[model samples]
Target: MRSRGLFSRCALVLGLVFLYVPILSMVIFSFNNSRLVTVWDAAHSPTLKWYVALAANEQILRAAWLSIRIALVASTGAVILGTLAGVALARFGAFRGRLLLAGMTTAPIVMPEVITGLSLLLLFVAMEQLIGWPKGVGAVTITLAHITFCMAYVTVVVQSRLAGMDESLEEAAMDLGARPGRVFFRITLPLILPAIASGWLLAFTLSWDDLVITQFVAGPGSSTLPMVIFSKVRFGVTPDVNALATILVLIVATGIGVSTVWMRYQQRRRERDVLLAAAANL
Candidate 1:
C-alpha cells in the first residue's frame, strides 16, 4: 500500500509537471531581456521590455481586440439561444420532434472542427452567391461560426443543469396561480442562474480559444489573436509572444481563483440558509 501510494503521488506530480512546466517556462521567458525567448541574458535579465513591446505592437493589439469583440458577441448570442433551447428541452416533456431538437443542438459538440469549419465555409460562400450579402468572409462570418459551435456547449451545460433540478418548485409556483412565464422568470430563471453564467463563460472561452474554425472563416484582414500567434510562431516565437501568453495565463489564473472562492462562499451560505430554515420550522 505504501509503495502504491508513493507511485500514485509520483504520477500526479509528473502529470502536473507535464502540464505546467511549459507554461512556467513561457512566463519566465516573457521577462527575459534577450530577443531570443529561449536564451536568457544573465547580465540584463528579467526586464519588462517584451511586455512594453507587446503593448505597442499594433497588429497584435488589433487582432486581440477583434478576438475579444467576436467572443463577447458570440457568447451573448449563444447564451440566449442555448438557454431557450435548454428550457424547451427540459420543461416541454417529450413533445413532438424533441429528439430532433436535442440532436441538432448537440451535433456541433460531437462534430469534428475541420468538418464544421468546412461546412460553414461552404455555407457562407453559398449564401453570398445567392443573396450577394456578407460580401466576403470577415469578422462577421467568424462570429457567426463561433456562435454556431459555442451554443452547443452552452446548451449541453444548461440542459444538464435543468435535467437534474427539482421540478417541485416550479410546480409549486404554478399552484400558487403563477403563469408559466412568471414562474420561469421569477423562480426557474433564478434557480438556473448559475448554470446560465457557467454556460456563458464556457461559450466565451470556446469562442476566444478557437483557431481551426476561425481560420476557415476569417478573411485577409480578419486574423484573430490565435491566427497571429500561429503565424508568428511558425517563423519563430519572440519574447513579445511569451509576454502575451504570460498575461493571458495570469488572467485565467485570477479568474479561476476568484470563482473558486465565490463557489465556496455560496456553498456555505446555502448550508447556513438551510439550517436556519430548519430551525425556524422547529
Candidate 2:
C-alpha cells in the first residue's frame, strides 16, 4: 500500500509538471532579451521589449478585441437560453417531449467540435443562400457557433443547481399570491445566481479558447487571438508570442482572484445578516 501510494503521488506530480512546465517556461521567456524564444543569453539580461512591442502589434490587438467581443456576446446569450432551459427541465418536471428536450440540450457537450463546426458551416451557407441575412461569416457567425455549444455547459450547471434547490421557497411565494414571474425574479433567480455566474464564466472561457469552430465559421480578416497565435507558432516561437501568452495568463489569473474574493465577501455578508436576524428573533 505504501509503495502504491508513493507511485500514485509521483504520477500526479509528474502529470502536473508535464501540464504546467511549458506554461511556466512560456511565461518566463516572455521577458527574453533575445528574439528567439528558445535561446537564453548568459551575458544578456531579460527585457520588456517584447511586451512593449505587443502593444503596437495591430493585427494581434484586433484579434484579441474580436475574441473578447465574441466571448462576451456568446456567454451572455448562452446564460439566458440555458437558464430558461434549465428552469423548464428542473421546475416543470414532466412535460411533453421532456426526454427529447433534455437530450438535445446536452447533445452538444458530447458532440465533437469538428462535427459541430462542419454542421454549423453548412447551416450558415444554407441560411445565406435562402435568406441572405448573414452574407458572410465573421464575429456574428463565430458568436452564434459559440452560443450553440456553450449553452450545453450552462444548462448543465444551472439544471444541477436547480435540482438540489428547495422547492418550498417558490411554493411559499406562490401561496402568498405571488405570480410565477415575481417568484422567479425575487426568489429563484437570486438563489441560482451563483450557478448562472459560473456558467457564464465557463461559457466565456470556452468561447475565448475556441479555435476549431471559429476557424470554420470565421471569414476574411476575422482571425481571433488563438488563430493569430497558431499562425505565428507555425513559423516558430517568438518572444512577442510568449509576451502575449503571459499577458493573457496574468489577466485571467487576476480576474479569477478578484471574482473569488468577491464571492467570499458576499457569502460572509449573507451569513452575517442571517446571524443578526436570528439574534433579533431570539
Candidate 3:
C-alpha cells in the first residue's frame, strides 16, 4: 500500500513537471538579456528589453489585436446560436430534423481540424463564385470560420448542463402563471448561467489559440497571434516571443486566480444564506 501510494504520488508529480517545465523555462528565459531565448547572459541577465521590444513590434501588436477581436466576436456569436441549439435538443424532444441538427452541431467537435479547414476554404470559394459575397478571405471569413467550429463546443456544454439540471424549478415557475419564455429567462437561464459562461470562455480560448483553421481562412493582413508566432518560430524563436508568451501566461494565471477566488466567495455566501434560512425556519 505504501509503495502503491508513493508510485501514484510520483506519477502525479511527473505529470505536473512534464506539463509545466516548458512554461517555467519560457517564463525564466523571457527575462534573459540575450537575443537567443534559451541562452542566459549572466553578466547582463534578467533585462526587460524583450518586453519593450514586444510592445514596439507593430506586426505582433496588430496580430494580437485582430485575434482578440475575432475571438470576442466568435465567442459571442457561438454562445447565442449554441444556446438556441442546446435548448432545442434538451427541451424539444424527438422533434423532426433533430437528428440532423444534433449531427451537424457535433460534427466539428469530432472532425479533424485539417479536414474542417479545407472544407471551409472550399465553401468560401464556392460561395464567392456563386453569390459574389465575401469576395476574398480575410478577418470576416476568419471570424465566421471560428464561429462555426466554436459553437459546437458551446452546444455540447449547454446541452450537458441542461440534461443534468432539475426541471422542477422551471415547471414550478410555469405553474405559477409564467410563460415559457419568462420561465426560461427567470429560472432556467440563471441556473445554467455558469455553463454558458464556461462555454463562452472555452470558445474564446479555442478561437484565439486556433492555428490550422485560421491559416486556411486567413488572407493577407489577417494574421492572428498564433499565425504570427508560428511564422516567427519557423525561422527562429527570439527573446521577444518568449516575452510575449510570459505576458500571456501571467494574464491567464491572474484571470484564473481571480475567478477561483470569486467563485469560492460566492459559494460561501450561498452556504451562509442557506444556513440563515434554515435557522430562521426553526
Candidate 4:
C-alpha cells in the first residue's frame, strides 16, 4: 500500500510537470526580443518588444475577439440543450432504445475530431442546399458546430452527477403533490446545480480550445484565435503569442481555482447540515 501511494504521488507530479512545462516555456519565450524564436538569450535577459507590437496587431486581436464571442454563445446554448437531455435521460426510464440513445450520446466522445469537423462541414453544406440557411460560414456556422460537440460534453458531465444522486428526494416531492415541473425546478435543478455549473465551464473551455472543427467551418476573414496562433507559430514563435497564451492560461486557471474553492465551500456546508441533522436525531 505504501509503495502504491508513493508510485501514485510520483506519477501525479510527473504528469503535472509534463503538462505545464510547454506552457511555462511559452510564457518565458513570449518575452524574447529576437525575431527568430529559436534564439533564447537567457544570459542577456529577455525583452517585451513582441507584446508591445501585439497591442497594435489589429487582425489577430479581431480574431481573438470573434473566437471569444462565439465560444460564449455556443457554450450557453450547449448547456441549456445538454442539461435538458441529461435530465430526461436520468429521470426517465422504460423508454425503448434508451441504451442505444445513451450510446449515441457518448459515441462522439471517442470519435476523431477530424471526422467530427468533416461531418459538420458536410451537414452545413447540405443544410445550405436544402434551406438556403447559414448563408456563408462565419460566426454562425462555427458557433453551431461548437454547440454540437459541447453538448456532448455537457450531457456526459450532467449524467454522471444525476447517477450519483439519490432519487428519493425527488420522489418525496412528487408524493407531496408537487407538479413534475415544480419538482424538477425546485428539487432536481438545485441538487444538480454544481454539476450543471461544471458542465457549462467544460463546454466553454472545449469550445474555446477547439481548432479542427472551427478550421473546417470558418469562412474567409473569420479566423479564430487558434487559427491566428497557428499562423504565427508557423513563422516559428513570438513573445507576443507567448504573452497572449499566458494571459489565456491565467484566465482559465483563475476561473477553475475560483470554481474549486466554491465547490469545496458548498461541500463543507452540506456536510455540516448533515451532521447537524444527525445530532438532532441523537
* Best-matching candidate per TM-score: 3
Show where candidate 2 strays beyond 4 Å. Answer: 1-10, 267-282
Q: Residue by residue across 1-282, what tens digits does model 4's lDDT show?
A: 999999999999999999999988877777776666658777655877777788889988898898889989999999998898788788788577778768867888888989999998888989999999989788899999999889988998888899899999999999999999999999999999988988888888888889988999999989998988888778665667877887788888898798789889999999999999999999
True-vs-predicted CA distance for residue 43, candidate 3, Å: 0.9
lDDT of 4: 0.87
Rank by lDDT, highest first: 3, 1, 2, 4
lDDT per residue as tens, model 2, 16-122? 99999999999988877887677886456488889889999999999999999999999999999999999999999899988997998989998988999999999
RMSD over all Cα atoms, model 3: 1.5
TM-scores for candidates 1 onward, in order: 0.92, 0.91, 0.95, 0.89
Per-residue lDDT for 59-156 in model 1, tens only? 99999999999999999999999998999899999999999989999889989899999999999999999999788999999999999899888888
- Local accuracy of candidate 3 as per-residue lDDT tens digits, 1-282: 999999999999999999999999999999999876677899998899999999999999999999999999999999999989998899888999999999999999989999999999999999999999898999999999999999999999999999998888988888899999998899888988999999999999999999999999999989999999999988887888899999989999999999999999999999999999999999
Model 3 quality (TM-score):
0.95
TM-score of 1: 0.92
- Deviation from native of the Cα of residue 219 in model 2, angstroms: 0.8
Q: How accurate is candidate 1 locally (lDDT)?
A: 0.94
Give the C-alpha miss distance for residue 201 in model 1, angstroms: 0.8
